[model samples]
Target: MTATTDESAFAAENAFGKGEPNIAYAQYFTGDSFLNNLVTDPECVVGVHNVTFAPGCRNNWHVHHATSGGGQVLICTAGSGWYQEEGKDAVSLTPGVVVFTRAGVKHWHGAKADSWFSHIALGVPGENTSNEWLEPVDDAHYAAL
Candidate 1:
C-alpha cells in the first residue's frame, strides 16, 4: 500500500518500528525514511538498523568501500521495494528477501512507487570500510520500473 502521513498508521503497519526522521541523511533520499537502531553497543561486531521507506522513497547510489572483507546485507521485512546494482536488473523486495551487496558495488534501493517498504541493514565488519554516497537514482529510470 502507498505511504501514509498518519504516524499511528505507519507504526501499526511497520513490524520493526520506526525511529526518528532521517534528517541526517535527508539530502541523499528522494522521500521520507526512518531509521531505528537495533544494535548500538560499541562492542557489537556488526552494525544493525531497521530502515523504513515511504512510498516512492529511495536512497542515492552508494558504495561501501573496504580494503578487506566489507559489504552490506539487507533483510527485507515489510511491503515491497526494488534493489538494483550498477549495470544490473532491479531485484524485487518483499518480506524475508535478503540481498548481499559487496563492498564497492554501486547500487541503490527504495520502496516501490505504490508501496511502503522496510528492511534491516547489516554493516559487515571490515578494515578501512567507508561509505561513499553518490548520485540519486534518475527519475526517468525509477518511473520506468
Candidate 2:
C-alpha cells in the first residue's frame, strides 16, 4: 500500500503514534515509511525515533560507520517485520523483540508483505558516525522471505 500520513489501524494501535512522511530518506526505501522523533532535545546524547513501515516497505542495504562505538538498537513496538544482515538469515520481528546492529554491519529491516511494522530506533553514541546507504533489497531477495 502507498505510504501516507493518514492514521491507519496500525497507527492507532501503536502507542508511539504514526509520524509524518519520511521524506528525507524516501529515496532509500522501497515503499512508504514514517518517522516520529521521540527525542528532539538537542541536549540528548542518544537519538531516538519511532519508525513505522508500510506493508512490503523496506529500506536498502546500508551501514552505520563509526570510529569507536556507534551502532543502532531497534525495539519492535507494533505489527510484524523482518530484519536481516548481509550473509545472514533474516530475523522475524514482533512486539517486544529487540535487535542490535553493530557499527559497519550491512543490514536492512522493514514490514512483512501483509503487516505493518513499527520500531523504536536508538542511535548509539560514538565518534565519527555516518550512514552509508547501499543498493535496494531487490524484489527477488525480498520475495524469498
**The candidate that achieves the highest TM-score relative to the unseen native structure:** 2
* TM-score, structure 1 vs. true: 0.92
Cα RMSD for candidate 2? 3.4
Compared with the true structure, what per-residue lDDT tens digits does model 2 show for residues 30-69?
Answer: 9999999998999999999999998899999999999999
How high is the CA lDDT of each candidate model? Answer: 0.90, 0.91
Against the hidden true structure, what lDDT does model 1 obtain? 0.90
Per-candidate TM equals 0.92, 0.94
Where model 2 places Cα greater than 4 Å from the true spot, the runs are 1-7
Residues 69-109, candidate 1: write the lDDT tens digits: 99999999877899999999999998889999999999999
RMSD of each: 2.1, 3.4
